[model samples]
Target: MATSSSQTLALQRNSSEQNRFMEKLMSKIFSFYDEQSLIDVTFKVSNPTALVPAHRLILAAASPYFENLFNGNQGTDPIIEINDIDSDIFERLITFCYTGQALITVDNVAAMLNAAIVLQMDDAKNRIVEYLMTRIDEYTLQSAYTLEHETKCEVLKQKIIEYETQNFIKISQSDEFLNFGAEKLQRILVSDNLNISREEDAFDAIQRWYNYDVPTRQQQLPLLIDCLRLTQFKVDFLMTHIQPLPGCELLAFKAVSWIREPTVRPMTNMRFTEPRGVSATNCGEKTILAVCSELNPKLQQYNKTEDKWQEYASINIDYGGYRTILKNDNLLFIGGWKSCATFNIVRSWNIRNKTWQNLPGMIQARRSHCVVELDDKIYAIGGRDGLSSVERYTTSDGWKLVNSLIDGRYDAGAVTLNGKIYIMGGYKIHNDKTNFYMDEHLQIKSVECYNPDSNTWTSCADMKLFHSSPGVAAHKGHIYVLGRGDEYSHVCVERYDPQQNTWSQICSLDVDPGYIACVLLDNKLWAIGGQSESAGKSCVSVFDEENFCWVERCLLPERKVCNCFVVPETLLFSM
Candidate 1:
């Protein structure tokens, strides 16, 4: 909050002088240096050098990330130089060490961008890139494109085009990029060699990848559907040159599948081969939905005849409670149990890479939370901690701050529709300052929704009953709420319609229950896992939409607070 301009100038001048002196002093420590590699130069500025000690300089940079900066060790052998970096970067690096602030400008922006990108400074890189992406125009883009290599040029061009397509004016009428099409991307003066060929062939290649079938490719469909929306309409006449290959429809389906359900989950259990009470649809018609689940730990694909959930590739990551998931063509698992950590660790798993990487640690570590994938970003909602507190993280713009909930609770329900986030129920937030539990219970019944696009929260209609009361799921035109108390829970089902901004009582659940996690399958709503006195039930239960009956199904591997996701075949079912 210090707004003094003179103070800033003095601080900057001093910081710069100190770093330059340090660099100069380091140079003097070792004239035995290799100019090209820059690694042999010594930082003999340790204690007994008769100068301000190296330990002193390091102690100055003692932020938490310093451990990561030093490769997770607080102390290490002094290094003169690091590879693949120059003095220009070194100055900035030293600046970060000297002062925790990094200011952006016309000159150092490019280096800062590169460094942040390399070091996984995701938040910083996004800010720099977004700023550059917006200010640079056609002339600048053309210059960069022409000056850079083909691969790098393509990458920049695609990013600019995407920035434009996603945020700016996109000429939606074009055809080549329509539904897996990429039209003449740049209107440039180029030779024949630079031209792309088999334009229709690209379309054919995409269509074949999805293999559009329900049970088989259903999990993979959402992403493909989203991509289809922004695709520039390619020429129908171009179809003459683009012949549909034998299976190109599937590939095309796969292209759009990117936006379908979003986020591909790593395989947990093996394939599950069976569905309870799958009967002939009146005329000997069999229902085949290749539904994958998070709770059951189904053996891979469980196809008795061929029985294997074919996995082509996998990105190994440490994750659990498969319920907290989000996807905008990228699988982001926000919160999950890690036995080593006191709270759920936050991590991101790129669907394509299959590798899990650590993200910013949550402010309040939690478990059994809900996450939503919107616009290629994630929003983590409430879940109880050792003490319940609400927190969220989004990766789209690199984990920036958003508003938090008015109160904290666990077992709360969350859903995202039309870009707004809605949160319902859980335990009360503990006010350590007051040192008492507020039994008002008034906060528990309320509903609050946050808008990231505007960074604000507004009240919505509250449920007639307790949401933390148990068993909630969202389906076509409604959010189904079930259960009420713990040992004394209710099977009372209520439906919420966001459009009308109203709630209505639906058919009550027909099974024994204490708590339930509900998900929609086909037109029917399925509520699973609630405590009951039923002898044969193992917690897994289903509701008959048409028949209005609840059918108790076979048990999941264990009792769980299941968070269900139904990604159609294209988004996640294995080959």
Candidate 2:
């Protein structure tokens, strides 16, 4: 028995050493392939044909297509002719086979996936599909769905379906949703995982799709209507909206019958009748809260769907220069100046209850400071009196000091993006040399970023122009800073790319340059009311990302220096 155990241990040691040897050998082989050394197989790829070299052993091991090709051909160092696949994609796949790494991005993912499928590289195909799954946004969902149909990848199909289910409301509003085929549309409408507020929304989406091209899509309406939970709709809605539709008359009658009689199921193929799994908030309509004045203390809510504004709530205290951050359902009002004095007080208003509660104050009293929320913690950074101190707040632990800024600044535009806090362009107060009591304010164009993981603040690329209390927001993985142009006549909008650590100016705002409040709502950047050259301007404008211009939206109630943020429509109605 002891001899047998010793022999087994020796075999295990040999197996471990063999794995180490194979790993080292593969690494060396990849290095040789990188240098174009020891290349035994060459692929002549079509579509602007290019020759790509690779080792047969690596390709055969990674892909069954190459394995079968190499086994059938007896010749050594054979040049294989490949067609249809782009040369770039084929080269990337060949490199992936050798090095086990591929540069799969949105631009190349579709081509790489198709090439992987053609080459019978299941592993590479799965990786590419997973990459596509992670990036299934409105812009890419249509292409991904098309790829799923072209490649016949069941996993990709299910992933796209699940994304449609989870984001049904948002997806329904997208142009891609209108382009969905009848079969694909039915798959999403039948899903129980759909995050919709009511069954009527599902019907509405179907109606919109049918109306997009009524001549071609009229016949698809009946089949698509079977996917909705008809019993979930109100009797009036069924009669008024569904029954009157050209193709939905039969489904509407069955739905009305099922709603009236609780015991019997509709004698039709409409399987989905129960309510969809809705989230806490109805995502169809969004409510934006704009706090314009401290003295007037009015909280206004703007309904995007209605294109109207109404007074929602009010704050009793008269304060100004405070920053507002909405976390979950709580809107936090952080440090501000009142009666010519700065206070460290922090107050939170529960949008659900419509009540305000005082929380723990900061370590230092600050006004005109930038407050941002990241990783479920709120950070108060750089404020008045040349304050370089920074503090963080959590519900359980209260407020604690974090890393201080490299330079003290107030009225800076701060935003959180990709797990980092960015503070950009503000004013720094410096004492005058001749008059000791007099203070001089200088506009700062410098920028700094804070990383919580490292607990450090690093300098970023400086803005082209100075920004004092400018509007800032993060969108599409980039930080957008809207600075009121001091030198130029237009408002300068610059976008900062974190990966490149660079800032580039995009289209300028059409409104007169001033201290404007910027917020991102419904995937669009909005510049709200701010003091223009003469007075506070009530004009509002939204950035058209595709057109690279700012288009005018609805105006605010009054022309004032106001901060705006998005909230659920339910929050405003709850009051």
Candidate 3:
């Protein structure tokens, strides 16, 4: 055993000595090559021709192109002519062959990468790809994308695509994006992973690209426009922007027809209607978004995994009673009141960018209105000042007055189920000649349903008791309304069945009623933050479907009149 151990130790020492010797020998070889000593082969690269000297053995060992050339050659020293590569790129590649190290920078990476691809140096190509990935940005993405096509580098291509998708808005505004060829622009526009809050931005990008070089790009407009999700565009946008663009008449007509009669006519292309990566429907991670009043401008997000609430983005203006709806990644804040003044202003908060934009306002300035999205359109229902008016917003046409409601009421609960919108009990004015002193309003138990296809409203079965400013959510084919009760501490829960046109009392919650926000998440109903008989409540409760009761989940950080909606979790944390 002692003799065997001694032999093993000797063998390890010898192996270590051999490795060090090889390292020294490689360094010497590289030094000689750097000094242009003992050069056996000369490479004459074209495009401002220049001669570069290298050792044949080192070149052959590092690249299969040189190995195959040397194996087929007959002379002791050979002169190789490379017509496609530049002299600087060829010299850099030869340096990589000798030292296994190359200076890769943004200025020359494209040319270097090309030379490496041509020489069949897999190691050099891989290193170049790694460097390119770290350096990819809006300025260099176009060059990288072009190199990807020229070299047929799948890895680089995928990385470029991912970067393009993530920073699409910024890239689209870059000079490189305007200079992109028709094919490259089409490749980006056709991506389902492009992170755009609205499809209008896609159209705007196309228009900008076209306007950059109208004479040359005009012919490609039709093909490029085909890549846009036409169904996602609002009717007004199509009419005002796309319809008059000369060649887009057909697409504009089609988009209008589809928006008006989506069920009547099947989409010409499914890809044009599919949502992008930033869309809530396509996002993998999701969270609950809580929008509080302007006084509490810090937005809150509920992390389901941790079961906690965290502060997210903030808004500048103070707002209350605004109805929020998620359209793709943009959370649309509809009509609401601020400082005793009602507003028709529509503000869009993009979850991906964490930026706010002013969209077209509604026709009616309203607060306490119920907003719901149906068939890719936003509908703002009745609100204060005895309003029975309804307005629908579309990306193509902006906001238009839709069919009026049957009974005008504010602080009503509204939710969508099975392609229809259901509005529950709300306060209504009761103008009586007998009461001469003051205007009287009372909470009513009337329910109405709106069908977008018919553009009409039909009365549904009324609830047992009136509920004003109640939290409403749709779960498992039933509409659940929580909290706003006539009597204090009598906050009742009720479920409405559209199929049977009936309402039933489910259970009562141990929290305040009105101003609560109810949302359907993970196949359950969650009621969050509202006012009670005494003060505002910050507690959150989830419906126990199996037991028909409200279960406490977690509490929010502060008590405020908050509107809760579900959004992609990435929108909350990624920004």
Candidate 4:
């Protein structure tokens, strides 16, 4: 009996507390002038002002899609209906102009987009339509990439393509974007997922998708190039030939970025560059040297002479990580450990001096990251200080944050092609655990290609496999991926043809070097000092350029992580 009375008393107290809270709220709302008391509460009368046009008012007050239905009714028996979209959602959207707080969710985004389209708000329609395409498929998104990529309306498609491309967007049909030839969506997810740089190859993926079939056979580079120059522009037709490569998007991209842009100039210079169009095929090859860590800061080169790592001088750096190869002659290895994420220590190993020299600090420290030299400025992609945020490291501006990538990636791959950086898969933070090696990671296959020129990122082809901390090198427009990954410490090497966007398995290594750092020298790939393929032995291996083969060589006396760089006058040095 005492417990029952106590419960009843508690309920009465809670009711009193609720009434007090409501009274306070009501006091604030009713204190303004013209506010008055109703039966027992306060109320405010709303006044109307100007009258709206009858037709405009009717349209505004009526069901949004009634006009479309009315027009359809003119033809025959019309169907009339209303959707069960909640009143809360409708009110939220309707009040958006005044409150600017419509919470658009994936479930209702399509409905809202459809509403915007019905309202004939072209800007709103285009924005919502593009957003909607992301939720759908490539065929649907394809129309958005280049309206012409799908339509018989060539002129219109061309205009849209030109518009999007200028906006630095690689437009495509809705379905195509969703159904990428590469692992684009997956690549942009999380760490421990994948780390593919356009500089690496993904040939093994090509074989899996196409096989030895005629279409799969064409996915190979040598075949795709032939198709690009000779065949038609049908995605299905291109897939039908799925050579050893992946698809023809890269070819189309090259044509658009290099061939089309250079020759088809705007109004003024158009006629002048006309002659350069047909000869775009002969553009010379471009090679870049990738510098690994502070411990083994090494220079990667692709001269195609097949004489790489044949006793070249090794250059040493004073620091680790944050590597930038300048002017094709010197390597700038600045910031990393000793300083972690601070710009405290800085130096550039002059290939001429074979010794380290100093440069300005980049405002902060960056490690296990990327450096892209474009238009003479370096852009440092995302890494970690045990956090996930994207920042660009430059000497002038320091470490100013940029747009956060679609994913939190580290040990990722990045390469610059035609001035754009295609960042591939990498290991990312899977979860937050306090004890053990409790990090959980998701190996990704999605890719984000950043355009330094426009300071924007576009989604692109993804890697075939998921790997963490794989070495990447871009050679003559193809990518070579080395090092070990999650499945096996080091199992094999793969090649990715950007033109076709596919991967293929190369020769499997008798030994695998998980997280082994690699560099391209004279058309050959050289991997050095990595944890053994599950056995934990430390050694270096080389892949033959001419013949697809692997050769294991010198072993490190003590197991140590090392970075190598070409030293002027000395040969390559592994620190």
Candidate 5:
């Protein structure tokens, strides 16, 4: 171990002083540009007859290309011929080596970048990249992309790639997207980061690109189409949108068959790489459906595009504790019973096949249980059994018992957020030894969290008031509990911050909607389908983040009982 004295450790003027000294030295060296007394080299540019005088020592020191040129010269003329670059751009490159600043403009920035690459002046190239980034727009985006490839500017290329991905729908419609050569077009098309909500948009863009110059681009269709995830699209979307295009019959046939059986994968040559960045499949015009009510097997879906609720699907399932959830294109009905004996049946309606399939039933016949999907597995936790048991189910694996809850609860609210499942206030049987049956069934505010990674349960901050069948949802790492705090002021919206390990009521409902269905969609909170003063009317309210209040939105077409989970387009299904 060594220690320095206080006087020796004292810092002043620092690196700035050394930079100033170097600047003065460089300034003195540059002052001899016009003096031929010690001149050793002359640089010339073509197309405009521009000549600049320079010393070999300064030029060679600043550029490796120049250093090798001057050291391996075949003649003593002390002259260098720089061609294919504009004189103005070349002058800026040389000036940057001396002053550490390059004059950048819209007209000359691209050419300056090219010149900087030739001279290997990284500082000048970076400054030019910054300038181009600030000036990027719809008109200049194509040129920036072109310059990215020519200069091998990775920073600029990354920016351009991001810009294109975020604005894929916008850029696909532009003329520049159509004119990009096959190689460049292939690069953009293969990127899963393209911000398109629908696979049809990607298909449409490829068609337009092919149509732009049909005779010239027809041969490149196989290369271009191979980059699309054709199997991801619905059968109807394939037939309606992609099949009609010329030269699409073979691909369309494959897509249709793949939709029927996703197991039949595409040939290696035709298969596309999985999406590479943030998923683009989460947004679109989607419908929310309310399924089988207490008495009726009829199902209804909210058609957002048409602004109507239409009968979408039907299944003979009872209403009590029967929960419906939508994941990808499938809608699942988990638990709930026509009676105590019939409660364990589980079925799923596939949107692609328009068919229903029965899945492996849960170990316990429980209703009013909480179900949440995480990591492609469905978790059914807490129900009428008043047992702390929890079960997890996956496509490949059947129902497997996981850890039980610390509190034996039924009619509890559970949601998964940030890799943990949160079970909120629910009716639970007290653990009193003497009067257990008499003091059973309590709505407690106690909250518990289940971490799947550790297979353990931990306590969380409880809600302000006790609640039964409270609506709960998780978004952006926060859990929101609705209809839980105050009954008279039924708009009890409490937000739980996991980082702080605390819960606080942020907003309340204007109307007292008891036991409402809560969900977080598109980063907004929604409460739907609950009994209020005006019961029997479909009521919905959304959290207005801008004003910090709950504002009423569209109402359901009919008085639907049960719950609703939102998809891309808000869909409400009743039981």
Candidate 6:
């Protein structure tokens, strides 16, 4: 029995070896060889007419259409004329006839698929279809549709329909959607899977589509109206916006009924999805507030559309370590640590008047502190003084004392997340060491949270390391800290989940080194000019939390470390 099993295994090994040898031989035989070829196929593809040598036996075995044509009729000269097929595509199909493989590219897949269909090459057609489906995207959606319509590929059409339905909102915003006619637009919008965040988006798209051909598309409003969920619109929106428009009579009528009766069914019978366009810089086209903390400290307003930065005014004295906040179009510069001394002075820049005004000062002098606006009131946390005292400021009422921190340390990182203020990592004088001559300070890694509802501050899990003057920002309900480190160590980028009360270390900014002067812009963390190991070049690094990488964007005209803010398309860097 053992001898018989060994003999069977040996026979299988020889068969495998013979199969590999035959594959190599076939690969060589598939190479272009015109000498003593069976037939010549003349292809009129472009300006140049070319002839490709092909084997009848290989073509007949590969494609039934080619087999039938070759076997049917033959004259004295076996020269076949092939039309309406690209020369390169025909050549690739011929190669696949012999080699059982072909190079399918994005540019050539459509032509190749057409040729495969004409020649009845099922293997080739299946391969090209797979390639086309994978490459279908926003840029090629129109081309895919054209191919599907011409070829009558039901499968391809269905793939495109699914894609268009799923990404209707994204595709509708694209220029291609704008260019398409009312018929095509209606077909796309009719899908129940159309993922629109707001009913206003559909209204806006229809308005834009109508505006594209105002004179002609007016008649097509009914076709467009049927796709819109008019009943989903609110009463105020209908009255103030849609009702004012000339073509929204149907929408306005339905919106009135929807408001009077809450249970009214929408035209599409689908729930109205709220807008999800929230981002790091939600302020659109507003004048950006630029505050530069440097010698000859300047306050500026940046107009993104014009790409212009106009200086508002300069402070009376040079200042550094000051925190600026934009509150209701008013720019406020509060507390700073300068060469001379720490400042408690507070000033305001009126955006409308472009003038400066002195606001009521804080209860305590503080600099290198963190200040954030919560519930329309500004809360100033620990600063250079390393005091536990906290203060809140309002327009109606001046600065007043609030709840103090459990641990007082200056140069801490602070941000408001999920309606609560979180303060983390700073340093205080090490009084226990008795090393006053050495100027010793201890960096604290403790983190605390302050709830505005209870007006109380409580401790949470400590950070992985001490972060002194670290850049802090809240995005998607999580707080990210980057750049600043303890005196003895450099801090890695860290993310704090409020629910878990835990910190996880991300990558370090070795390339974009320095204290992180980061601000959330365009849903990305924009790290401005900071102290860098890279020759102190004023560099900008954009951190994509989704991809978990810091991408170097551009270098500043000068190596000036400044606090930066973004408004729409413009970025304001304050040195």
lDDT of 1 at 386: 26
Please, what are the lDDT tens digits per residue for candidate 3 over residues 101-120?
A: 89988888888877787788
Total colliding residue pairs, candidate 3: 8
The parts of candidate 2 lying over 4 Å away from their true place are 1-284, 431-439, 487-489, 531-537
Model 5 agreement with the true structure over 171-253: per-residue lDDT tens digits: 88898888878866666766656778877687788888888899888877766776678777778877887676667777777
The number of clashing residue pairs in each candidate reads 70, 0, 8, 106, 8, 1
Writing each residue's lDDT as its tens digit, candidate 6 over 132-205 gives 87877632877887897788654465567667767877777788777877766776665545667776877787
Candidate 2 residue lDDT tens string, 1-575:
74474554554557767578779988999889988898887888888889998888888778767877888854364688888899988998888887777899888888888888888776687688888888876337778767877877655665676778888889899988888888667757755567787777887898889999999987777777776777778899889988887778988988887788754542332334445542113334675788777665678788787676777877776668788887656678888987889989998766655566677898899998999887557999999888888999865367999999998999888998766899988888775679766657778889998987678999998988888888889988788888674745667788887655678777677666655777778788888764344454466788876445578766666666557777667657753
* Residue 157 in model 6: lDDT: 56
Q: Tell me each candidate's TM-score.
A: 0.43, 0.54, 0.54, 0.41, 0.51, 0.47
Candidate 4 TM-score, C-alpha based = 0.41
Model 6: lDDT to the true structure: 0.67
Estimate the lDDT of model 2: 0.77
Question: Superposing all C-alpha atoms, what RMSD in Å does each candidate have to the true structure?
Answer: 22.8, 20.7, 24.2, 23.4, 19.0, 22.4
Q: Find the 10 residues in a row with the least total lDDT in model 2.
A: 265-274
Write down the RMSD of candidate 3 (Cα, Å): 24.2
How much is 300 displaced in model 4, in angstroms? 12
